[model samples]
Target: MNEQPPGRRLGRGLAALIGDVNSPTPEPANQLAPDRTVPIELVSPNPRNPRRGFDEADLIDLAQSIQKHGVVQPVVVRPSPDQSGRYEIVAGERRWRAAQRAGLAELPVIVRDVDNRTALELAIIENVQRADLNPVEEARGYQQLIDEHGYSQADLGQVIGKSRSHVANTLRLLKLPDVVHDMLVSGTLSAGHARTLVTADNPAEVARRIAEDGLSVRQAEALAQTPAAERPSISRSAPAAKDADVLLLEKKLSDAIGMRVTIALKGNVGELKLVCRSLEPLDELCRRLGQG
Candidate 1:
């Protein structure tokens, strides 16, 4: 058997929490005394969890340790009312899985009383606040807040105690290509590196370069500032603002049409555009032109 290296020795904190390492264990979420212990079966991994998967070798080592030590710590679980006779895991999936691999029939579990949304939000926030979440997971949380619960970016800031800009910035990471996202998750890239990428219309190409160049966050920011004359094909950009005459013509169109009209510049000459939503508005516009 390999001996524990000085730098890799089991920590006192882990020992104290689990009693021994072989047993299924739960890591403490909050400051508490006399940590409650229960079986691994009582807990479940989160469905919309951030962490993709644990390393197999590390897990195998953990399992071997479990065989020798038993779960030193307890796992946290909440009784499932919907699925009677089974409990949903609040946390400690790693220990639970390790115990299973170790062939432990039952692992220590601690029952918790967490509300659903509160539990989900807590799980997400736990990963996020630790900087453990990948960009994809972080974006999913921001989106969940916006789409599922109808919270605005400002509201998300209040809920998570983060700035709205932070929320927006994190959400922007979703725009990155899948390859870049994989890199971010695998620790080959950082979120700050990913942030600069989201602004690019062709983010995949930018992500590739960012990885290839081994660019620092500051360097990435500088790169992001560069004009896109030499980059790969991207969508046509928004048109530049129209000249004064075009703006005046838009105003004139609105006066003649009697509706909210926007005249956006097309090219050098620019162009006038008309918009009328309601039937009444359209009829009035026509009537004003003697074409009713």
Candidate 2:
């Protein structure tokens, strides 16, 4: 009796959509047969690849690895639409670039016949799964799929293995100023810090404070709520004014729990008010506090 081939029955999902050839060692049952190998001169990077920037340091590291180990995983490619006898990368562009840096002459690739939509989806999925996209690039990729392909937020969540709320929140990052987006892309700001700034009245100012003061995400949340005029004054000549650290602490609690939090202290006897925006955030806050 003959045994069935591996990956031949991967029913109707991403693995089937793109060729199941991501593994370092291609199993005879799962690997793309014919084992297409293209010269480095014939392959071009996909213009629509969702990833915008590659860190030079990282590329050097990858190039060094490729030099030592050779490319273990084959890149996914399709015939170039514009040029004859040329291939466009559908996934693994980074590896391809590193191969060039390592002075490689050819690369192994899985040639898949795919249209524009499939190509875009494969690129996005591959980058996201590998955690290669920055927040801005990730949001832009999500927006492209939604706008061009008509994917709903819930549908996108399912595609990317995230929650609907998480998708919604990530989409909100696009509303921030270009500077803030740049900060996120360059790793000057954390995703948590960037998310809290989305709803801020003045995101640029908040971003500046975050970079300058090295404020924690929780502290940034408090800074967003405390009006600009009131913040610096907390340390000034107001004898009756509340302590600055106390205000920051209150804001941290509010941000951490996703609610409106206030603390009023009278000689160490204080009242705490945690205001919930809705039932869901409230439940989340309660759940988080319980975990704490």
Candidate 3:
């Protein structure tokens, strides 16, 4: 009588899916052997693959590796529903691209008969696990799954091995302007800095300053929090001077944790704050403090 949760419907987590794709050992008795060599021309990239850009240098490096050693891992594919004999790639497209550059006539493949939804899910899972998808691409992939397949944020977190908060935060990246999205795609701005700018009055201007001036994620957070009228045009503008010791300590703490650190002192009392761009650093900060 009760409704089942969507997260439970994600039959297996990323670990199991990854194992299915890249397990080094022989296939288990219960599972069908996905191993098969297919003509390179018969396999094509999925149009729906969430990853939009591949680094030329990284691909060339991979191609050189494939040329020397061959593709150790098989590319995952499924029979194209529209085309009679050709196959559509579900995962491992990067290796496929590299293999083409390596001039391989045939490729090793793991063929599965899955529908459109499962194909997208597999693609997203593989890319997300490998950290290959940029924040925008990653968020778009999540949105696609939700829009087309009725997946909840909790469902995505369960499938991808990320926290619900991580999923939520990543999705928020989509609300920024196109210029900000371009910054994310081009690697000019980090997800952390971009996250802080999402609610800024003029995210594009702040984002450009952050990139040009090389501000830390924490500094970007402070700038975003400040009203536009009060914010200095240049990041190097002078402000009320702090004690030399306090400035030194701030730099040291910021360097230690890779975030901005600030100290405020009042009559013999003080407050210390650490600015983190994302949950990962915050978790690390917590861990380090707990150990001490």
Candidate 4:
């Protein structure tokens, strides 16, 4: 007997379940047209899906919540092509399943008249911006954007308010061995730890150390940082300011820019220098300082 891989199986099942991944979107009625509002029936959701388990008891509780508070967020949906009037959920599976469990017949949904490209992009942006989406969901969303929507990391970065390198780095995290990914997704590991592990030939070993050692982000960065064959000793620091005003100004600048600012006093003249971790941070600091 042959068995389909999990990814392949998931894809096949989803394909068979809905005409389009975004088909669950509901269409709004046009006042100009006589024909408006299509009929959609409640259907049993597939249990095998990796999404979530919607409890009936929980649903009753949610129904009470909805009855009291109403639907704060709109459910996402896609139109039905096989049936005359039906829609499937691209996202918000839990809400739909809960609404059904709550004994609600119809859900207020936005029917996005969008193709695959628009659908995946919007879904990714919404999930990423909301900050509710977990790393795995985010990774999946990014993968969908690239595979289905023809988006590069640069495109995704712009869409999600992240730098292109950020997107690329995050995607690379997905390539870590499944064990490492499991640790990442389960919160046993951090993005920084995973990033450092990328340099290791055996990431599993690094992941094991991360789990057992409980490495801090700084510690992980230290391990990841290049080790010099002959380490140089850092010189002792001395305050450059001769007077209180100059020291106060350096501290003030540091606080305002959220970085370390140093004033080196040599005789009558003092050199002001700002140190930052990255270009974006430096640029942002410069912009604020320039404004002041």
- The best candidate by TM-score is 3
Candidates in order, TM-scores: namely: 0.58, 0.72, 0.74, 0.55
- Candidate with top lDDT is 3
lDDT of 1 by residue, 1-292 (tens): 5644211232332233223322222234432342455455655676756556566765786687779777654565567746776677655566678888998877667566666754565555555543445677788877875676566787666545579899999888887778888887787788888898766666666776777777778777666666667543333335576669867877887886666677655455544556443223453454455633
Off by over 4 Å in 4: 1-64, 224-292
User: Arrange candidates by lDDT, highest first: which order?
Assistant: 3, 2, 1, 4
Q: Is candidate 1 or candidate 4 better by TM-score?
A: 1
Better of 3 and 4 by lDDT: 3
- Please identify model 3 stretches exceeding 4 Å from their true place: 1-34, 233-292
Model 1 / residue 272 / CA error / Å: 61
Cα-based lDDT for every prediction: 0.62, 0.76, 0.81, 0.56
Per TM-score, what order, best first?
3, 2, 1, 4
**What would the per-residue lDDT of candidate 3 be over residues 41-68, giving only the tens digit for each residue?**
9999999999999888768867877887
1-292, model 2: which lDDT tens digit per residue?
5522211222134565444433323345654443578898999999999998987866786787778777766788889989999999988898888889999999988787788877887788667756789999989998988898777887777666678998898899999999999899989998889988877889988898887777877788888777777765222223467789989998898778766788888895989987542223454554555667
What's the lDDT of the predicted structure labeled candidate 2? 0.76
Clash numbers, per candidate: 19, 0, 0, 10
TM-score of 3: 0.74
Give, for candidate 2, the lowest lDDT window spanning 10 residues. Answer: 3-12
